[model samples]
Target: MEDQREIAYVESVARGWTMEDGEDLSAMRRALREVRARALPMNMSMDLIRRTAEERWSS
Candidate 1:
């Protein structure tokens, strides 16, 4: 049997978030966009990529 891999499964991975109520959703999406541009080409693991994205959102 071949081993299976799950990609982009949000529940199985750690999420980086600490948003207060009423935060701007557009801002969060912008941050994620920047992080995605940087993280996607680093050849990093998905967990690392997600963590990085979260940091980008907060920062």
Candidate 2:
């Protein structure tokens, strides 16, 4: 269901993205590498992106 959307902005951003696409793949991996540096210190969910999503859309 994640692939389905109703908003134009979301559809616009999602239209052409795919992991198989080689566009900016290296930089994307590097950014993910930086994200992987975050540690699960003292009991925390490894879900920083969910927090980012909530912050982005829960206005």
Candidate 3:
């Protein structure tokens, strides 16, 4: 499973959003960590994940 930091970084990149500095960034990271921890795992293959990511970015 991917860590919170990695998930946050990927989400930021995917949405083309700039990560703010200071306390806001810390809060955001904390929230993401919590959310990720509660999320269910998907039984998908790497190819499917890659394809989905590609499709999302390509749109």
Candidate 4:
């Protein structure tokens, strides 16, 4: 419930950005890349991560 609302709010905020919006998407991609880089060496499967990323953008 609360988590859904928070996620919705974050998505809304992200959608408000244009290509000119500096650093937001870059920072997110960087953070995600860092996390993926670290997790892959530890054998983490990123299927869910990919799905979440796709779902967010496709929404």
Kindly list the per-residue Cα lDDT of model 3 for residues 3-48, writing each as its tens digit: 4442223344447555545576778878889998876566555667
Ranking by lDDT: 3, 1, 4, 2
- Residue 13 error, candidate 1, Å: 17
Q: Can you write out model 1's per-residue Cα lDDT over 1-59, one digit (the tens) per residue?
A: 14542222123256644443334545666777999887644555777878888999876
lDDT of each: 0.57, 0.56, 0.65, 0.56
Residue-pair clashes, model 4: 0
TM-score of each model, in listed order = 0.32, 0.34, 0.40, 0.33
Query: Higher-TM-score candidate among 1 and 2?
Result: 2
User: Model 4, 1-59: lDDT tens per residue?
Assistant: 44542111133644753332346656666787898777754324577677778989876
Candidate 2 per-residue lDDT, tens place, 6-44, comes to 222112554853443344556676677887887464335
Q: Pick the candidate with the highest lDDT.
A: 3
Q: Model 2: clashing residue pairs?
A: none
Q: After superposition, how far is residue 50 of candidate 1 from its true place, in Å?
A: 17
Per-model tally of clashing residue pairs = 0, 0, 0, 0
Judged by TM-score relative to the true structure, which candidate is superior, 2 or 4? 2
User: Deviation in angstroms for 47 in model 2?
Assistant: 12
